[model samples]
Target: MLIKRVFNNNVALTEDLDHTEMVVMGKGLAFQKRPGDEIDTEKIEKTFITPSEGFANKLSELLDEIPYEIMVLAKDIIEMATSELNTELNDSLYLSLADHIHFALTRLKDGIPIKNALMWEVQKFYKDEYQVARKVLELIEARTGQRLPEDESASIALHLFNARQDCSRMEETVKMTAIVGDISDIVKYHYSINFDVESMNYSRFITHLRYFAYRMLRGELNDDQNDMLYEQVKMQYPEAFECSRKVQAYLEREYQMQMTKDELAYFMIHIQRVTSREKS
Candidate 1:
C-alpha cells in the first residue's frame, strides 16, 4: 500500500490495492516517508478500516496527537469487550474510546479526576458492561502502569453501552439508562420489594426496559390493540398491574408519553414475573 498522508513517525493514512482508505499504525512505519511512498508491510502492526471518510480523517488527526501505544491499548480493550459481550460494537468506538482513555490518563496524571455521576445507575443496570469495563481497567493498569479509580469503570461501561446501541449520541444512552433505573425504582417501591439482579427474570425485565426506553426516545409507540389481554392481566395480576400503572404515570408525567394497552400488558406481565419470583 502507498502512503496517502503521514501523520507521524508511527502512523499514516494509506490506501489498499482496491483504493479503500485505511489508517495504518506501527513503530516508525512512516519515518522518512512521504505521500505516495510505499508502506513497509512488516512494520504495519495495526490497520483500521474506518466506516467513512470523515471518520478516517478524524482518526488520522487523533493518531497524530495520541501515542501509538494508547491506540493499540484501546484496540485490545475493544476486542476483549466484543468477545466478552458477544456483540459487534460500532467502529466509531475506536476513536471515541481511545480519545477518552488518552485524556483520562492525562487527568489522572495531573491529579484532576472527574467522577461519573451515574456510577450507581450504570453498575446496577449494566452489570455485564460494568464487569467488562472493570476488566478494561485492569488491562490499562497492566499496560500503562496507571491505576485509574474504580469510578472510571462506570464511564467506560457507558462508552461500551453506547457503542452497542444504535443511538449516535452518548447523551441518549445516558437518558435511556436513567429511564430504566427510574422505572425499575417505581416497580420496586410499588411492590415494596428488592430485586435479585442475578435472577433470570430480572435480566429479562431489564432487557425489556432497555428496548422500551430506546423505542420511547425514538418516538416509536406500540399501538397494538390488546385490550382483551390487558384486561385479563389486570384481573389476574392486580398488584403487578398497579405497579405498571405507576410506571406508566411516571413516563407520562416526566416524558409526556402515554403507553398503549399492549405496552401496559407486557409491562404488567414482566412485573408480575419478576415480583412474583422475588416474593416466592
Candidate 2:
C-alpha cells in the first residue's frame, strides 16, 4: 500500500487497491517515510480499514493524540471481545475504546479516578459483557502496570455492550442501562422480591428490558393491537400484570414514552416467570 499520510513513526494512512483508506500500524513502519512512499508489508502489525471518510478523519485525529500502545491495547481487547462474544461489532469501537482507555489511564495517573454509577446494574444485567470487561481490565493492568479501579470494568463493559448494538452513541447505552435498572427496581418493589440474577428467568427478564429500552429510545412502538392476548395475560397473571402496569407508568412518567398493550403483555409474561421463579 502507498502511504497517503504518516501519523507517526509507527503509524501511517494508506489506501488499498479499491481506494479505501486504511490506517496501518507497526514499529518504525513509517520511519523516514513520506506521503506516497510504499509501505513495508513485513513491518505491518495491524491495519484498520476505515469504512467512511468521516471515520477515517476522526481515527487519524485520535491516533495523533493517543499513545500507539493504547491503540494496540484497545485493538487487542476488541479482538478478544469479538472472539468471546461471537458477534460482529461496529468499527467505531476502535476509536472510542482507545480514546476512553487513554483518558482513563491519564485520569488514574493524575489521581482523578471516575466512578461508574451503573457498576452494580452492569455487573448484574450484562453478565457476559461484564466478564469480558473484567478480563480486559486484567489485560490493561498487565500491559500498563496500572490497575484501574473496579468501576472501570463497568465502563469498559458499557463500551463492549454498546459496540454490540446498532446504536452509535454511548449516551443511548447509558440511558438504556438506567432505564433497565429503574424498571427492575419497579418490579422488585412492586412484588417485594429480590431477583435471582443468576436464574434463567431473570436473564430472560433483563434481555426483555434491554430490547424494550432500545425500542423506546428509537420510538419503535409496538402498535399491534393484541387486545385479546393482553386481556388473557392480564387475567392469568394478575399480580405480574399489576407490576407491569407500574413499570409502564414509571417509563411514561420518567421518560415520557408510552408503552403499548402488546409490550405490556410481553412484559407481564417475563415478569410472571421471574417473580414466580423467585417465589418458588
Candidate 3:
C-alpha cells in the first residue's frame, strides 16, 4: 500500500486496493517517506480498519499524537480481552481505549486522580475483566513509569464491557453497573450470606445479573408463557423464590419495572444455586 499521509516515522495513513482507508503503525515505516511512497509490508505492526469514517479520522488524529508503543498496548489489550471473553469487541475500542489510556497516564503525571464510582460493581460483576484491567494498570506503570489510581481498573473494565455489548453510550454501561450492584446487594442482604464470589455459581449469577440488568434498563421482558416451572420452583425452593420476590420488588420500586413469572422462575433457579449452601 502507498502512504497517503505520514504521521511520523512509525505511522501513516494509507488506502487499500479497495480504496478503504487504514491507519498503519510500525517502527520507522514512514521514515523519510512522502505521500505515494510504498509502505514496507514487513514493517507493518498494525492496521486499523474502522467501520465509521468519523472514528477512523479520530483514530488517525490519535495516532498522530500518541506513541506507537501505547497504541500497540491498547491493541494487545483488545486481543487479550477478545480471547479471554470469546467476544468480538467493537473496533472503536482501538481509538477509545488508546485515547483514554494516554490521557489517564497524563492525568496521573499531573497528580490528578479520578475515582470510578462503579468500581465495586465492576469488580463483582465483571470479575475477570476487572482482573485483567488491574493487570493492565501494572503494565502501564511498568512501561510508562507513571502509576494510575486503582479506580482506573474499573474504568478499563467498563471499556471492555462496553466493547463486549457494542454499547453506544457510556451512560448505558454505568446504568448497567448500578443495576447489577443494587441487585447484588439486595440478594446478599436478603440471604444474609456473603456470596462466594469466586464460585462457579456466583460467576454464573453475575453473568445472569448483567444481562438481566441490561434487559431491565431497556424495558425488555420475556414473553408471557404459562408454565408449570414457576409453581415447581416455588415449591422446591421456597426461600429462593421469596428472595427473588424481594428482588423483583426492589426492581419495581427503584426502576418502575416488573418481572414476568417466567423471568422469576429462572431467577429463582439461579438464586437457589447460589444460595443453596446457605439454605442447607
Candidate 4:
C-alpha cells in the first residue's frame, strides 16, 4: 500500500487500488514521510479495513487532522459502542471524539494543558469514565506542566472504558420483557402463577448479572437485595427454576464444585436474563 496522507510521526493513511482508505498503524509509517510517498512496507503493523466506502471516507476525513494512533483507537471503540449500546451516534461524534483523544495525547506528550471536550455530558452520561479521566489528567499534569480540561478528560475517560471490549459489539442486548413474557406464559399454563412484573428494574438486574456472575460463582450470593429476587424468581419463573436446577447439575458434573443455594438463585436469574436479552 502507498502512503496517501500522514497524520503524525507514527500514523498515516493509505489507499488500495480499489480506492479504499486504509489507516496504517506503526511508528515509522510517517516518521519522515509525506503524502504521495510510498510508506515503508516493513513499518506498517496493522490496518482497519473499513466495512464500506462511506465508512472509509468518514475515517479518511478524521485521519486528516487527528493523531493517527488515538484516532485509530477511537474508531475501534465507536464501532463497538454503536453495536453494543444499540444507539446511533451522529457521524460527527465519531470524528470529533477521535480527534479529541489524539490531540489530547499529543498535548500530554508535550507540556500543554489537557482539556475536556464535553464536561457536562461526561458527568451526566459517564460518571465512572469522568473520574478515571480526571485521574489520568492529574498524572499527566504531574509529569508535564499542563492540565487537560474536564471535557477533554471526560473523553479520555471514555477511551479508557473503550480499552476493554471482551463482549460483542453487534450482539443484541437482552431485554427482560421478552423473558417476562415467556415466564408469564409458561407459568400460566404450568401452575397458574400470576403476577405483574413490568416496570421493574429487570434491565438493571441483568447489567448486574454481567458484573456479578463470576462473584456469585466463587461463593454464595450475599447481597442483601437478592433475598427478594430469589423469592420472586421462584414465585414467578418455575420453568427458569428448572433450568437453574439443570445448570447446577451440569456444573457439578463438569466442574466438580458444590453449587450453593445462592449460586443457584443467581444462575437462574442470569440464564433467564441472558436467554431473553439475546432474543430481540
Decoy 1 TM-score against native: 0.63
Candidate 1 weakest ten by summed lDDT:
117-126
lDDT of 1 by residue, 1-280 (tens): 9999888898888998899888888999999999999999999888877677688678777877789899989988999999999988887899999999999999999999897755765675568899999999999999999999999999899889878835656888899999999999998888889999998789878977886898789886666768898999999999988888889889989999989888898889889988998888
The clash number for model 3 is 0
* Candidate 3, pairs of clashing residues: none
TM-score of each: 0.63, 0.64, 0.61, 0.35
Worst 10-residue lDDT window, candidate 2: 117-126
lDDT order of candidates, best first?
A: 1, 2, 3, 4
lDDT tens string, model 4, 125-189?
45555665566566545644566666666666555444434222332223223334443444334
Instruction: Report the Cα lDDT for residue 225, model 4.
Output: 44
Q: Which lDDT tens digits does candidate 3 get at residues 1-280?
A: 8888887888788887898888888899999999998899999998877568686567668877888899988987888788877778888888889999999988887888887756665665567779888888887888778778999999998888778755555898898889888888888998898987887778878877886787667765665654798898889999888899999998888888878888888789888887886556
Off by over 4 Å in 2: 165-212, 215-246, 249-280
lDDT of 2 by residue, 202-270 (tens): 876787688678768988666777899899999999998889888878887888877778778878888
Which of the two, 1 or 2, has more TM-score?
2
TM-score of 3: 0.61
Q: How much lDDT does each candidate structure score? A: 0.87, 0.86, 0.82, 0.55
Best-matching candidate per TM-score: 2
Cα deviation at 163, candidate 3, in Å, is 1.1
